[model samples]
Target: MSDEACRLDVWLHRARFMRTRALAAAFVEAGRVRVTRGGVQQRVDRPGRTVRIGDELVSPSAAA
Candidate 1:
C-alpha cells in the first residue's frame, strides 16, 4: 500500500457505496468485495486493506 492509499472501508464510505464505514467493513469482511491490483484480482476480506487510485473494486449488486 502506498501513501496515496486509503482503507477499503473508508474508501467505500467516501464513495457513497455504503451508508457507513461499519457497513462497508462488514461488506468487505464478508468477502463480498473483490479488488484488482497490479492486474491480479483477489477477494477483500478485511476492511483495513488499502486501496490506491488505480485499484478496481468489485462488489455484488445490492438487492433492490
Candidate 2:
C-alpha cells in the first residue's frame, strides 16, 4: 500500500484504539470492526485491508 494508505491494524494502533498491531488484527479477524467511507459502511475482517484518511473505523468497545 502507498504511504497515503495504511494497513487497518497499523492504523488502529496509531489511532490508539489498540495497544498493539496484533491486537488490532485479531479484533478485525473477529469481525468486530467496521469501516465507512462515502456514506457506505463495510465490515473489515482483514488486518491487511487498506485504510485511508477520512475513512471511519468502528471497533468493539475497549472497556470490554
Q: Best lDDT goes to which candidate?
A: 1
1-64 per-residue lDDT for model 1 (tens digits): 6679999999999999999999989989999999999999999899999889899998888661
Off by over 4 Å in 2: none
Error of 2 at 62 (Å): 2.8
* Residue 2 local lDDT, model 1: 64
Q: State how far residue 14 of model 2 sits from its true place (Å).
A: 2.1
> What would you estimate as the lDDT of candidate 1?
0.91
| CA lDDT of every candidate | 0.91, 0.88
What is the C-alpha lDDT profile of model 2 across 18-63, one tens digit per residue?
8999998998998998999999999989999998989998866867
